[model samples]
Target: MKPQSMLFTIYGEYVRHYGSEIWIGSLTKLMGEFGLSEPAVRAAISRMLRQGWLESRKVGNRSYYSVSERGKKRLEEAAARIYKVETDVWDGKWCIASYNIPEERRALRDQLRKELGWMGFGMLTTSTWISPNNLSDRVKELTEAHEITEYVEIFTSEHMGWSNPKQLVQKCWDIDEINEKYKSFIDAYREEYEQLSAKMSNGEAVPDSHCFVEKTKLVHQYRKFLFIDPDLPQELLPELWLGKEADELFQNYYQLLNPGAVRFFETVYEAAPSA
Candidate 1:
């Protein structure tokens, strides 16, 4: 993995397990497991802390860091943007060409499929190939993202096509279903937010641990969209699918976790989806 992707994975794991409250020893252990050096680990942690993705507390002689409420919200937003549903019409001209992957790398092939699905590849058949409606830039993205630029082949043909538009629509409806699932979450969150606001207005004591509640709420709010379709392979996500706007959203979410940065990210998240 590249440095940026590695950092994202590391931070993602930390947030998932420790929710930002991490110690040096734990970080060191993570580094060892990931085969990262102490300096690299420390640098990544410091960078995230500086970027407001983490908050540090000094008690006695030890320091611990945890994801702030803002951080948690940002993470939720990032997850949504990364896995949000996209409505694209398939153009039916292009198709994916996969080769005989080694038995040892079968897991890798599965990973590729999941990635591809995230990137918009529909599995037409098992190992033979996968494709999206319009293959233009998505193809290039898959190549680089999977590091199979030279290994995989792309062809324009109609050898095996989906004859049932209804079935195809249903298959592609995962995004819509996922969006609906999250809508309920968002609605519940709205209700909770209203209650929380009313309590605050009544001069009720809002405990510091409420931050955890906020984090949990955000996770629940977006958890429905976290994973790709289980049936899909993981490694086939097109890198280009995460365009500049997505990158901007990710960065904005990271920054928005700081106090006073919420509005900025909210606007970005609510902005029109990419083309």
Candidate 2:
């Protein structure tokens, strides 16, 4: 994994739970488990700082970093979805965003598109994005943050088209493609989960450091779904959707590895001098 992406996973899974702050040296040391070089970690930290995802502080000779408020909001949003087992009831409404940004402001336009996708909106056209989820608050936040309120319009309404909801869903996202990705995850991890469960049940000893690496890798791999899966409501999803199954396996595996992982992480984290 790239240092920046791994850092996000680390923050979301670990540091975000334990004070949301860490010494720079502790971060580098933890990152070493994934074979990320200290220089790469530093560079990634600098990039995140410039992007406003991280804020830095200094105490005497040591530097410390923490997720910014903006970053914390994003991380909290992601965590809610990441750990979500039950799909929320759909009100049969779509949240639509339409923008007429001028070509001269192409950079702003591109950023808006990215933000829309991150907020689970799928592109129906170059300037029109839609989602089945209620995202009015997030849309308002995006518009206000980017100063694009005048260029964008938000609507929440039922689609009155000839096509059915499933058809509309198919058009917006490749359900089959997303399902195949979930299948891949299940195929890769099912055996690992069974093996680990067997080990634990048999009283076999697994190293805390090893469990930390496994759990981190598991979370890193599973978190990629946040980018690809828009997480449509159950009524819109196909009957054989593997997302719930994948989530079950992920949760079980995570719980199996969590205790040891926490111990290992705390050992490294608490040893660092407070800054």
Candidate 3:
């Protein structure tokens, strides 16, 4: 992970759990949890403080720190960027499911696999189903959209023993119980996407800094709906989806504006061509 990203994640955890009052030791502990070295942790903290994301008080030999309002806002935004929700429950019909994803949605398929893993989908064999969830409506939509229906199949009950009990214990992917936890997040994302689309159509500039901050918050909150992949090399498939969604939404909005602006902004933002 990028140092800045790691720093924000650590800072967010501290603020969320301990409020604004945090000690260096607690921060250090979080760093260890994330497998970061002490020096890297300190550097991230220093950078965050310098950026006005954290405020520190010096007393004796120790410096106590807490997230400033600016820091809090940034952390919230980062959380939105980093977190997402799963919309389905695994019925445990399979141990690992495989899908022959379309080229157009390769990224999306990769993202779904990562998310399914995060939600407890295991891989007994590549592209084979192994989640404990019964297929849900949302999952169906996602799979269909990615055109992987034929490639997917439920595993028989006999496949259960294939899972490594130790690994399963360590990484739980049961996400059915948390469906309600994602309602607000899904609503917020849809609302933001719609509003941003409108604003772009009206030729309004992408809101002010404060509004941008709020948008970022919504983006972070929006992530709670997607599944994450634990087995994937990078655990950011959800983040990648958000970026792609944002780019698509922006392009749609831009096209509604003056024609010339579309190419201009696309070049500046370096957006992928719309699918």
| Predicted model with the maximum lDDT | 2
**Please, what are the lDDT tens digits per residue for candidate 1 over residues 146-241?**
676655666666535545433553454354454455444544455555675577669876553343324323433333244543222222232323
Q: Judged by TM-score relative to the true structure, which candidate is superior, 1 or 3?
A: 1
TM-scores, each model vs. reference: 0.43, 0.97, 0.31
lDDT of 2 by residue, 181-216 (tens): 999999999999999899999999999999999999
Model 3: per-residue Cα lDDT over 1-275, one tens digit each: 55566555444533444445556765565445446787887898799889677877766666677778866754574454344333343333434455766687677677777746545465544555454444344356556756677755533453346445435423443323333344434444556557766776688775243342343233333343334323221221332233334434433432343243222322222111222
Each model's C-alpha lDDT?
A: 0.49, 0.92, 0.49
Q: Which model is ahead, 1 or 2, in terms of lDDT? A: 2
Full ranking by lDDT: 2, 3, 1
RMSD score of candidate 2 (Å): 1.4
TM-score of 2: 0.97
The total number of steric clashes, by the backbone 3 Å criterion, in model 1 comes to: 19
lDDT of 2: 0.92
TM-score of 1: 0.43
Candidate 2: Cα lDDT at 65: 92
